[model samples]
Target chain A: MAEQAFVTGKIETPVGTVPQVATGVSWRDRWGAFRVRLGFGRMRYTVEPGLYGVGAPRQDSPVLVTANYKLSFDHLRTALAGHDAWILVLDTSGINVWCAAGKGTFGTAPLSVQVAASRLAQLVGHRRLVVPQLGAPGIAAHAVKRQCGFSVVFGPVQARHLPEFLGRGMQATPAMRRKTFSLSERAVLVPVELVIACKWALPLAVVLSGISGLFGPAAFWENVREHGGWTMAGLGSGIVAGTVLTPLLLPVLPGRAFSLKGAVAGLMAGLAFLAVLLSRPGGAGNDFAVWAWLLLIPAIASFFGMEFTGASTYTSLSGVRKEMRIAVPLQVAATLCGMLLLFCARRLP
Target chain B: MRRRQLYLRGVATLRLEQDGCMGCGMCLAVCPQEVFVMAHGKARISEQDACMECGACMMNCPAGVIWVQSGVGCAQAVFHAMLGRGSEACCAIEEKPGGGSCC
Candidate 1:
């Protein structure tokens, strides 16, 4: 594909790639971010990997580096809305810097390759590249300087602090480098978790409703109307507890294992389920629905909790393994017990 | 100032090969958590209590002294494992789940 030519609102660099970018997020960017939260067209959310002009940057401007993932790119540019900096975006294959760094795609090879390909040396007078702190995993600073003759300086952990970081002579306070998974960040992840779980869950509910026909139409529909609602609620709350609540409340949840914490959250959600069911008299046989949710909700929540550990800033692979050894079987046992209760509930007089 | 503790106890998913450590400050510089401190210029684990185990130090260490079984910690992988399939839960692993709808 031909490299895009210089446009009216773009900064032209010597590299021949005239990357166009505006200061704040466009409506498309906003909509795209919102769409991603809902798990719609997530993989497709990528910009072309190359250099972009944040403002009218000069040759002496400090060059900031980032991943080609559109969301990551947008965050960087948007944060620097009023600044003039040369943004050199590497092709991380649409993955964010933090994740792509872990996967090894956003490493030295690509950084060097993009630097050379973009003719960055000729474009800028300095030999320093400002990289995001999270991309430190994939990058070897000394090696980049050795290979490309450009020293790498990792910026603050959050791009929001970019202005302060730059204003303070590019030095980060300890707080700036600190990685925080705030409540809002944790909550933002819930929509996608809910979307993915519901993909199979809603369908399973429909199929299970049909399967309930073996118990006769009246019983089947009764099961469909009563048990199905609880099942959906169980699944929804489980996703919330595991992915959102667990991470947000990770520090407070008892036990070291993520699954354990999730189970606690699930148990709470299960109690809530019971309270709702008790209020409605005909909501499935009281004993069966209560027993099933009590078992199932926590189990489902446990799985989500352990899963959230993968996304957490506190989990280890070894820790996760240890957790799995103990937690999985228990989660399975609880889930199966719930299923067994449901199985028995289906057949009762 | 003390930060809020968010991790569980005695479960730091990290290993430091003391023999190979060049006492380089890479781990100290790269770690987001205050997991390491330089003692006599040697990288030592002062508080591995809440290490996110992102493996930035492991990846950046010139001496290859740091080790972390790094991968995404999503529960979906556990779900896959239960189904007798690879826990393709994280993007860092051999395969990514759902065509890369990572959270």
Candidate 2:
């Protein structure tokens, strides 16, 4: 097979000619990362699972393990810039280390198998492998040692901290071990959320707009132009409120439940939409329509917000289940009531 | 910076059978939330509420003392589970031919 573009050269090892990878991420790599962030070709962005050399590693070099997901591999390689290391890329089906580990694809079995497949025992002098800390969820350190004769030493949570952690003799500080959901980290997730939301929102908007045009007083096209436009705007606002605003202002948003926080953001977006509507010529004349939107926006936003709990860092399975039990019913009821009010408004005026 | 806390305090299902712990300290080394600490050669829960139920400690523990209803804390996954889809359905990418989907 042809070598990947990121492969700069080859290192002659006892097992075979191991591909030597670039330590610096190229513009192409950056663009690929950006594309995946937008949810395009994300699952397909994987490198071949094998052993790769970085910075002319020798038999005594540390063997760092990571997933075959190109992004994860890139992060690890880039962090090891000036250091000589052997990267044992495990087959993780294109998922990142953390998520892959959660799925058990990055567990003890894969680690042991990869170690044997790469002939790492012969390639490295030491009987140790530095696994990413997040992979601990799947990796049984004792089991890996027993199965492969190599003890597992988990590295820091983020690959960027590798240099410092390695400099400190592979000891991660408390801060390095802990994962934080900072603003920038949350912000990067917004694009994919928005894209996924739009996939359903656009179609739902069309359906709702069509239904609105069927009942309003004016001619079909005329009503479609007025009511339908407002319907699209309302749905758009709800999507933005849930997927964008809720995540951006997560910490400050009131209520502990993600659904509640999303509702607040949705209500704010609804009010902003109302403000824009009222400022227009012959402001939305129907009070029922106004009430409909007031209910619908928050409901829509809340549902989306609740979905975000999947993406959030701190939420626990038990806590999310508890929140969902109450939140789902409320969201459904509010949506039904909002639709009823909207129908009433359209029928009258 | 202060860590942001999640809702419903003391809600995590994470439990430790103290008698079974061998004090290997794997839980302390692997936990991302600092939920575990070594005390008297055995692992103890230092911050139970902080546990995100990632199952790192449980998976890494040699003594099999830790237990939690481990799964993604995602509402989407819950909804999928409610609809008869598997709990791992959250954030599933479109699968290519001969490939599997993932979060």
Candidate 3:
């Protein structure tokens, strides 16, 4: 019943009656995807794992396999607008195709089990199942064939190309097979990154502002208004630099390490913040505080930038470890030194 | 413009034993980075640096001749690992009472 919004009808197969899904993505699906991108109910967004039909699939229709994540299912069904296809979804615990494949949930065992559970052999006359290319990391084609009696054909990386791929007899071109992190792809990831960063940064900003009032010759509230405002600005700048600027300028930014690129973006943001601080009347209060902002902003930004490696498509575990070995120590040292400077600035007359 | 997006150089842990290769070309087809290529009827490591160590080739290779220490290149996961949370630290929802997992 939860999936009734997308399920338009039911198709009767030799095995049983399968839910027939609509090929067009409704406004509800779009809203759901947008909410997930904004970090709402992301982990629970899943569909029922089983066999589904699109456009009245027959026994000879090509079988397309995917993860149980609702987003993945929506994309696949939406792509096959006019085509009749059987969608065999594996239980990946709501994870997308690529990440689930890496975790082995989309691998041979689950595929084999789903094949048997769905009685796919009896429903489909063809012996081929089109799995997403990204799922290759977890699935052994030979092993799947040996266990389930279905030959696995790795499909194109994106669902948009499904129509063309199916049209060409399931043959994917080199471009279709390759994965590229485009501007839009990088942009879409930014919202979740910003939301995550803000959850911690906003609270930290308030604490830093409250601590800023503990010193200075001015009244506690006035100092809080001036110095505390500066601290909040610095934290905000770091968040924007790390989560927004770093991802948008990922390719063109200097340095191969994500931390280094983040530091560069942080430096730019820090300089801008400093310029604004200096330009304001009576804004330049404690010189040590200025130095603190310079160091702290970049350190914070660099750490957030490094966090993006997990979301990136090309970073390796070894490379991330190597970068962390050097960058983590430097970031820690900078943060400590910056905090120490802030203490000195506040304690001084 | 084709901006070159390169990660750390010469640090990928991917290794392939040429003798055990079956020339199935599965590695070539599955590799998103195109790290493998068919050379003289055998799969070869064409671009070692480009590999993200996702282990697609190793998993799909029927011969089981490839080896790579595969894991996510995420700093949050590394931090969790440092806290002894193990390598499976990925996007798990409600990992704690009210704590959400990092993506």
Candidate 4:
């Protein structure tokens, strides 16, 4: 009995996967044929910014630094489908390079040690390690050079531009250095934040609707159904705008601060709410409701949008601090005032 | 690009000890300041002032060797906390169990 024990069954959890190579030809030119692809299969390894050989290449290939997130790693590898490169992954706790760099995981000292431990010095003859532009917040090129005898060369923000960057002898033009937050970029964010927000909103809605029943079926129930629905819709749309649309249209949207851009988007959403309200037949008689909306819609949208600043690249710590000092109280006051007016109107009637 | 260091006043007086660092590289991975570096096979605080004192490194460190007594400067988080949700619930609002209003 002690010698043999039977294990009947086990369940395998599905971790995100990535493909080793991409299929379908993308861009074909004199140099080579590029392919576009997607996969969840990323090499399972802790990022330590050391030299890594890809596709059985020897150690002397061009060293490229990236974040540990599987997606980030896949994108980096995908863009270099036909090239040989030494990928140095920084330990970012499975976060993307840009966010991790912003949080400080992809910085100088760890990078140096990883390089040493990975025996990067012996692999390549040249001391130049190419790092992404966004990783600048955490990495000091000068420090890495002094410590590891490797001069850090800053690369383009987009992995797709790697060929062009390397072709030009590591010179990054304005377009390469500048990061773009496009529609595709913004759309990807919607699922996560919306999923997170809805988890809370659903339960609260159930409770609010429940409590309103105690005041009498006709008035309180009606109020909950109508007003509660409006609030949920508005809150949901605001979250979508800030986390999705705002970042996607970041350049086209107004103002340098992400909050301001989010505010502008929220204002657009507010106008849409007002339009819907005005379109109703009893719109004029419900002046108090209209007023409540006028105060609250933009405020809710603005607050939601402002919350996204933490996740964006455009906002600075000091700038966010200053914005919060001014923006928060105004949002709270507006929301409270709107709630109070609506409550008063119902109570009196 | 000229790397810009956003000047922070309070962090200068704060003491950040990396002496007992296990070289697990978690701090080097999470710090936004490019502050930590490995010297003599151990992690050390290289750039002191660049730290925003985000305390993410402190929170995520497995060994609890990293310590930074810092607070979030985000107004939204502060507002949530002022509304009675603890400040710890601030920056990580999305990470909350049932993500919703701070209440």
Across A1-349, the per-residue lDDT of candidate 4 in tens digits comes to 1110111122121211111233123333111211111111112222333334444334356888887654566567668767766677777755566655544667788788878876667666778898876676567666788789998777888889998988888787666754444457555555554554455457855753454443323576686765566656655555666656665666677665555666677677766876876787754236675676666666766666676654443333555666677777887898789767655544443
lDDT of each: 0.75, 0.87, 0.87, 0.57
Q: What DockQ do the predictions score, one after another?
A: 0.48, 0.57, 0.64, 0.08
For each candidate, C-alpha RMSD in Å?
3.2, 2.0, 1.6, 11.4
Regions more than 4 Å wrong, model 2: A1-3, B87-102
Per-candidate TM-score against the hidden true structure: 0.89, 0.95, 0.96, 0.65
- Model 3, A1-349: lDDT tens per residue? 2646888899988898999999897899999999888877787788989999999789799999999888999999999999999999998878888888887888899999999999998998889999999999889899999999999999999999999999998999877878788889899999989988998888898888888887756788988986887888889999899999999999988999999999999999999998998898866566987898899989999999999998888889899999999999999999999989988888785
Which rank order by DockQ, best down to worst?
A: 3, 2, 1, 4
User: Best by TM-score, which number?
Assistant: 3
**Model 2 over residues A1-349: C-alpha lDDT tens digits?**
3558999999998999999999998999999999888777788888999999999899889999999889899999999999999999998878888877887888899999999999999988899999999999889999999999999999999999999998999898989988888889889889888887887788888888888777778888888998898889999899899999999999899988899999999999999999998898877678987898999999999999988887888788888889888998899999999999999988985
Residue B27's C-alpha lDDT in candidate 1? Answer: 78
Span of 10 residues, lowest total lDDT, candidate 4 chain A = A30-39
Model 4 Cα interface RMS deviation (Å): 9.7
Best first by TM-score, ranked: 3, 2, 1, 4
For every candidate, how close is chain A to the native chain A in TM-score? Answer: 0.91, 0.98, 0.97, 0.76
Candidate number with the higher DockQ (1 or 2): 2
Clashing pairs for predicted structure model 3, backbone only? none
